[model samples]
Target: MNRLSTNIFRRSDALKSKPDTSAKQPFRVRTGFLILILSASISLANAEPQNQKNEILAELNAAATRVETVKASLQVGIPHPTAALVQWTEALVAYRKNPEFLYLKGYQPLVPLYFLLKSDSDAFSLFVPRVYKVFRGKNKIFDTSIDIDIALIPQDIILALKPLRINDTDHTEWKLAKDQTAFELTVKDKEGKILRKIIIDSSEHVRYQVEYNDAGFPYLEIWKDDWRDTGSIFFPYEIKMKRSLPKKNELVLKFKEIRPNEKLEEKLFQDTFPKDAEVVELKESSG
Candidate 1:
C-alpha cells in the first residue's frame, strides 16, 4: 500500500476495538455531558468579572450625572519653543450635556475667532473674523471624531467616568499605578493595539491626567488642575496640554470663573456666518 493508505489503515487498526456501535449512544451522551459542564463553568467564571466591572461603572455614572453644563472664561497661552514669542488669547468656553455641544470665542489681538463643536454631527465649525472665513469639517481647527477637544472645553469629571466601549471589555485593561497614587485604564483595538490610556486618582476620585498618541512621535500629555467645588460637581479650573512634534509647545488655560449648570441661549450654538464671511467646506480626504 502507498504511504497514505498505510497511514489510514494504521489509524483504523488502532480503533479496531472501539465500543460496539449498539452501545455507542452512551459514549456519545457522556462526551456531550462533559462538554456542557465545561461550558457552564467557563460562563460562570466570566459572569462574575463582568458583574464587578458593571458595579464600578455604575458609581462613575452616578457622579457624572450631577452636572448638566459648565461655562468658563479662559485665558489661553501658546508658546513657541524655537522663537521667544508666546502668543496669548482670551476665550469664552461653554459646554453642555456630555457629547452634546461645545462653544468657544477666542479674542485674538488681530481678530476674534469662534469655534463650535457639535457632537451630534461629528464635526466642528470655526468662524474667523480677520479673514471672515468659516471652515467646517472633520479635520479642521481640531480633530472631530475622537472628540479630543472634549478633554479641553469642559474637561469635566464625566470624561473619566464615561466608558469607551461598554459591551466588550476584551480590549480594556486597567491597573493601579506603581506609585499607588492613581489608577490607569488602557484601551486597545481589536488587533490588540493600544489606542489610549486614561489615568485617574482614586484618592481624589477624579481624572488627574490623560496620555495618548497623536500625529507625532512622542505621546501627547494633558494635565487638569486648579479644582474647585461647584456645589453639584468638582471641576478643574485650569488645564495644561503639552505636545512634542520634534519641538515642544504647550497650551495653558486659566479659567477666571466657571458656572456649572448655567442656562445658555439656543442661538449661541448656531453656526451663523457673517454677511461678508467666506465659507469653506473642507473636502473629504481620500486617505
Candidate 2:
C-alpha cells in the first residue's frame, strides 16, 4: 500500500562486509528493500474501526476545540535482516549527502491529519491522502500519476512527539491541551515493547518532549523541538524520524513552506495518465 513512501534504498556498497565469508553471495537481496513489497491504502487498520466513527463525530461536537498529538503505530517484525554485501553504515553516513537515488515523497500535514499505516517485512508505511499533482524531477512540466504513502520531516521534536509502538494497545497517545493539541496514537504488537513518551506543551505555542525504552536500550532524548503559530493552532516547524532501536537508520525532511486546506482538483485523484507517459498499472491494496 505504501511502498512508494518508505524511502528505502538500494545501496550497492552496503553488500560488502569484512572477512569475506561468502565469496559468492547471490544477487543482492535486501530484506529492507523486499519489505517494501507489501502495500496498503487509505482505509487503515485502526482497531477502533466501528467505534472510532462515533468517537470522531463526538470530538467534532465542539468543532472549535484543540486536539493533541497524532501518530502511526506498527509492531516491528523482521524474519531476517537485509543481505548487504558489506557493512556500509560508516561509509554511507560519511558521504550520504549525495544519495544516488530517492523515492518520491508524498504528503505529511503540517497540521495533524488522518494516517494510513501498512506494515511490511520490518519497515512500515504511513501516509496522508489528498488530491494533487506531482512534477517529475527531470521535467517540471510533466505531471505524474502518484499516490504517495510517506511523508518526511526535519530533525527536531523527537521528544515533543513521543512516537511509539508498544507490545500492547491500538491507539497512540498524545497529551491533549486544554482545548489545544491532541493526537492519534500508534503502538506495536511486540510482546515487551514499551511506548515512547512525549510531553506536549500547549502553552502559548505547542511543543513536545518524546522518549522511550526498547529492549532495555536507553534512548531518551528531546529532538529538533521548534513550533510555529498557525493562526488557529500550533505545529512543529522542525521534525525528524529515525530507527529507534537495533539500528541507526534515519529520514529527515524540511518544509520549505506550508499551505493548508487548499481545494483539490477532481482529476488528480483519478488514475488517468498524462500524455507522453506510460499508463502505469496501479494495484488496489484495499478492498
Candidate 3:
C-alpha cells in the first residue's frame, strides 16, 4: 500500500511539472493583439501630420492655378540709403503663366525703365529710355549700380507675388504658431539646405515669405497685406520687399488696380528696344 501511494504521488508531481498551455495560449494571443493595436496607433500618428501638410499644399496650389494672367497698375516706393525721402514711381505690370513671362514699365520723370522677362527662353531685356541703353541677357542680370540681381528674375518675382508650388522631392516642415493663428512652413532642398520659409494665415493666405539663396542665405523678404477676396481668389493690394546681402533696399508696391485671368496680347511680353538705343548683349561666363 505504501509503494502504491509513492507511485501515485510521483504521477501527481509529474502533472504539476507539465505547463498549462491552454492558459498560456490565451496570453500569447492577447499580447499579439496588443502589439497590433500599438502598431496601428503609431501608423495613424505618422499619417495625420502628413495629411495636414498635404491639405495645406493643395490649398495653396489651387489658389495659384486660379491665376493665369495678371495685369496691374501699381505705385512703387523706392528707398535709397543716401536719400532722405522715398521716391515713388508708377508702374504697369503684366504676368503670364505656363510659359512664364513678365513685363514691367515704370514711369519716372528722370528715368523711365522697362523690363521684360521670357522664362521659357531664359532671356531678359532691360531698357532705360533716359540713358538710351538696352541690356539683353541670358540667365541672371547682376548690376549693383541698378540694383538688379536674381531677385528680378521672373521666377523669383513671381514667387514673391504668388504662392509657390512645392514639389514632392522638396523637404517640407511645418509648425503651428503657439497662438494657433498661423502656420510656418520651411522648405528645403534634397541636400537639406533651406530654400524658403513662409507664413500662412488661417485663411490660407501667405502673409510673409523669406527666400534663400543657393548658399542658404536670406536675400529677400516679402510681406503681403491688405488682402481682399476677388471672387476667384484672395489678392493682396499691398506688397513689400526687403532686399539684403548684395544691397539693402526696400520696395513697396501698392496696387491701384488688379485684373486677374485677363486676356493679354502676346506682344505685351515682347522686348521693344528702340532702334536708336545702344544694345549691350551679355554673354554667359565660362567658369
Error of 2 at 109 (Å): 24
Tell me the tens digit of each residue's lDDT in model 2 across 27-119: 334454444443221223222334443444343322223422222221111112344322111000000011111112232336233322222
- True lDDT of residue 166, candidate 3: 79
Question: Could you list the CA RMSD of all candidates, in the order they appear?
Answer: 17.7, 24.5, 16.2
Top candidate, metric TM-score: 3
**lDDT values of the candidates?**
0.56, 0.31, 0.70
Candidate 2 C-alpha error for residue 29, in Å: 71
Considering every candidate listed, which one attains the maximal lDDT?
3
TM-score-superior candidate, 1 or 2? 1
TM-score of each: 0.59, 0.29, 0.70
Q: What is residue 89's positional error in candidate 2, in angstroms?
A: 21
CA deviation > 4 Å runs, candidate 1: 1-59, 81-85, 108-120, 139-172, 188-195, 205-220, 243-250, 284-287
Question: What TM value does model 2 have?
Answer: 0.29
lDDT per residue for candidate 1 within 78-168, as digits (tens), equals 6665687666778877666754666766786655553333332356666656566766654322322221222232222223222223235
Poorly placed runs, candidate 3 (over 4 Å): 1-52, 108-120, 143-155, 178-180, 282-287
